[model samples]
Target: MPKKKSTFFNSVRFRIMAIMIVLGIVPSLVIAKAVIHSYEKRAVSLRISNVRNQCDILCNQLVGVGYLENPSSKVIERQLEVLSNVYSGRILVINHSFKIIKDTYGLDEGKTVIAADVIRCLQGEVTSDYNKKNKYIELTVPIKDPEQQEQQGVMLISISTGEIASSVELLERNGMFFWAIIAVAVVLISYMASRVLVKPFNKITKAIEEITDGYQKEDILVEDYTETELITDAFNKMLNRMKILDESRQEFVSNVSHELKTPMTSMKVLADSLVGQQGVPEELYQEFLQDITMEIDRENKIITDLLSLVKLDKKASDLRVEHLHIDDLLELILKRLRPIADKRNIDLILDCFRPVEADVDEVKFTLAISNLVENGIKYNVDDGWVRVSLDADHKYFYVMVADSGMGIPEESLERIFERFYRVDKSHSREIGGTGLGLSIARSSVLMHHGTLNVSSKEEEGTTFTVRIPLSYIP
Candidate 1:
């Protein structure tokens, strides 16, 4: 017994959905990281700019109020406290001598400044630092004495990066949540798409399974699936071919049964006539024996033809191929069959195209041609004519045999080469013809990689044409 097939995850729909999920997740995560990074950088830069502008405004105000000569620490401290409260950032004032004069947090009132941005500001230049020990945007703006037109000191500002970092972390968390939602949506959409895409294939698979279970006529029905039309077309073509093969198989069985039954019936009748208790005369016994012998020969011929067909089917590739003159070969075959033709008063004629040659197996090629010639003679009226001719072109060699015989019906011409198909059953049996002759002839011609065709009209005549490719010569 065959094992049952497993269905868990065995469908194309599931596999396609899995593949899409795996391929889409990584790139989405990378894009989310980049977006978060860009937002954080912009936030930090904006905070730094705002703090710098506030410090510039305070320095200008102090100079305008005539407090630059030696501004008291308490007055500077008051200004710094108001600005720091408004901007939410630390403020520091450093003098030209690099001394901290005022600080909003009041951490260093008399200490010398060592910060890089403060040192540059004391030298009459504006500077800023982003990466500093204070984790802030540190900036310095030069303080000029308005009446002297010279720098008296610099104002330093430090804005904390904590707000930027906090916003960035929040945005990143929200982005993660959004990405999770997107991933789930993607998987659901992929699963839906895969289900739609594989629906037709599932139908086809079911049809095939039905065929496997002996429902040979089942068909896959799909509508308007343009994307998979090629697959559908190929599958339909294969099924059509299988249908033809099945029909041929049934016909073969029928033909074999009929062919075997006829001879067995004949033998049984002849045996009964000879062995019946009514005493038989010597002359009648001889006739009954002859009848039995004929039937036995007919049975043997059928079996021989069947065995030959089997061998040809199996060993066609093993035939010996060689270059031989077709004219000489035909002449030899005709000479051998001439005695039979003479006995029937049939006129045998040959129209030889000189030096016609082809690549073919000698024995098989002769057998095919001999069968055609014999068929012509066997079917012809006494003293009727049979003509054999050779025609050739650059690419092909043709052997045609025409006989003035009881020609086949137009409808039966095509099936004449089918095993056990006889157009004139009574005539065939009268002439001791086993219906396998044309079938064997066709198979032999096919073994040489050639074609054999017949044309006939009732009561007129029949012509058999055999074409062999010249280039196929060894």
Candidate 2:
């Protein structure tokens, strides 16, 4: 038994399923990441705006109450502390001299704190910076003297982004769980869809298998897809062709048996007559011997024709192709068969339209054309004409043999090329025909990758046309 293929990885179903899974999962991951990052950004912006507004209000109060110079106000200190605690951050109030007047954490109150953000704020610029890695939003808000409209101090604050981080982490966990469910659903759906899509092919395979095992003889129909329909149609055509070939083979064998036996039976009867006689006359003996010899010759002709057919049935590679003048070839063929035509007083004629050359197997091509020409002559009326014509074009040359003879019946025309098939069996036998001439001729033309076609009408005439390419293809 042949080794079975890996069911999942090696199959079309697996590839389709894998593509679906990737399609389903990749986009989900991208959208989830984008949503989470957007949330983090929005939350940070809102937190920064809220804290900055509160700082602005406090700085206005400090300027109005003269608290920067006083350094001690119960209301201002309480408000600053409440703002710091609300956002989980630290605040620093700096004077014009860059001294920390009040630190919400109470650690840097006596220190001289000089930072880039603090200096920028004192120059009347409000600035904010976000540190994603540190998870904080830093801001610097300027405090100004209202009457002079000049900078007095700066309020610098750093707010923690711990809440945003926690929210993002939670969203990520939920998204992962949701994506897992969707991934499972997609895999299941894709697997089933793949199987459904491939079902028709499986049916076609099963139908072929049943035919191979001799369990079924009917043609298959798979219309699930256009492709499947096309495949089924092609297979049916091939199956029908095989059936026809098989029937032809059987018919050919049966005809061979009957034809071979007829000559043998005739010879046996002639021989038995002489043997059973006590005193046979010398003239009578000669006649019996002559009859016996005639039967033997007929049998030999049948065998020879059969052998020729068998060789023609062999591969085309057996042909020894050569370049030859087609007009000259036809003339030579007609020359050889002129005596036979003359015996019946049939006017044998050859008409060449133009000089032509072609690649052909010289012996096989000659045999095929010779058979056609001979048939024209043998089946012609006494004193009637048989015309053999040769014509050529750029790519192909044509040979046509037309005879004014007893034409074939329309019904028998189709089967004329079948081995041992005869239009008129009695007439064919009288003319020493083995009924294999047309079949051999056709096979020879086919071997050279050419075509032989015949057209006829009863009691009128018959014409055989052979078309061969100027250059042999294979």
Candidate 3:
């Protein structure tokens, strides 16, 4: 269960769901809040306007009928009572002397009322205010004498906001209920959307799991999105490469077993023949021993070449690098293989375009170049020429080994660097070739971050070019 929770939190689906929820719900909530506050503000403004209009009418009547001077009008008094009852508020009608002539509540009649709103209204400026905490609206309206163009008195009104408060409460409750439904809908939609979006990735995962579990080796197709298509292509390429490597490993093991067993079998046969003989001739016995010894030597050579290939295949960090003159290096390699070339009556030549220096592992570099030059001599026609050339640019040094030899077949050129691959098997065996020289040489060049390429034509000749960086990176 804990693992499942961790997986969910880390998954793309959860992130998508979270993003959708935030996008869908947060803005609606903000707008809803703004809308509620706006309604309240607009409602208060309209309420204040209506009350002010009524007060203005009453103030006009007071001045026209001379009601403030008389103070005994039952009609005006009843009207004031009705207005106060309708609005559930208090109203005070004051004279120019600041003496209240009529108080609807009858609590402050004949008394002086001194307030900033009233004083301001008496000076021809109407004033109004709302106290949110107290839930009330307060305002003062002026009584003006029209012909005189002067202010007579101020009528102060304080109205209860309980009605607006009730409406706001109802709106808030309804809003909460509406948002509850919206929140649930948002969550459901986000969850469904996330699941739909991640479906292709889940399919890709299942396909990969099947491959890793050894249940399937076929390529997968998930083109629901462009990203999924790219992933599918990359995965299929990796799977195909793994398949090729697996096949190569199995073939290598089989080849190693066969090659190792053949020499042993021959030696066993030679030993058994000597043991089975009652009276073998000294000369024949010596000949049989020589044959057995040759098989043993062949087996040893195969083992040695295999070990060299293994070492070359190791990490490039194992290289013991040093700067050496590349032209001189090529000269020394040719000198070492000159004896073999002389035995075959092959001319070994070295040409240096200019003196060059490069960082290299001397032992591995020598082995790689010697194999090329020796192969040139070993596979050449009688009295054929083998030329070793050296050249250099700013970044890299180049070596070319060209020989007048029975060149490689077109099909065999590609597999020449593969282990135990030989172009002419019979001739290779006759010349004591173990077929690992090219593979070892290729591995050595690769370790130094270089490339070895070959071009040849049948019964004509072959040319091998080696390029290595002047400086070793590692």
Positional deviation of residue 380's Cα in model 3 after best superposition, in angstroms: 1.5
lDDT of 1: 0.81
Per-candidate local distance difference test: 0.81, 0.90, 0.90
Q: Which stretches of candidate 1 lie over 4 Å from their true place?
A: 1-15, 22-31, 65-67, 81-129, 132-134, 142-153, 188-196, 227-230, 457-460
Q: Lowest summed lDDT over 10 consecutive residues: which window, candidate 2?
A: 211-220
Candidate that would win on TM-score:
3
**Cα RMSD, each candidate:** 4.3, 3.7, 3.2
- Off by more than 4 A, model 2: 1-10, 144-150, 265-292, 325-339, 342-357, 383-385, 389-396, 453-460, 470-473
TM-scores, each model vs. reference: 0.83, 0.85, 0.90
Better of 1 and 2 by TM-score: 2
Error of 2 at 391 (Å): 4.6
- For 269-354, candidate 3 gives per-residue lDDT tens digits of 99999999889989989999999999999999899999998898788889999999988888888888888888879999999999
lDDT at 201, model 1: 75
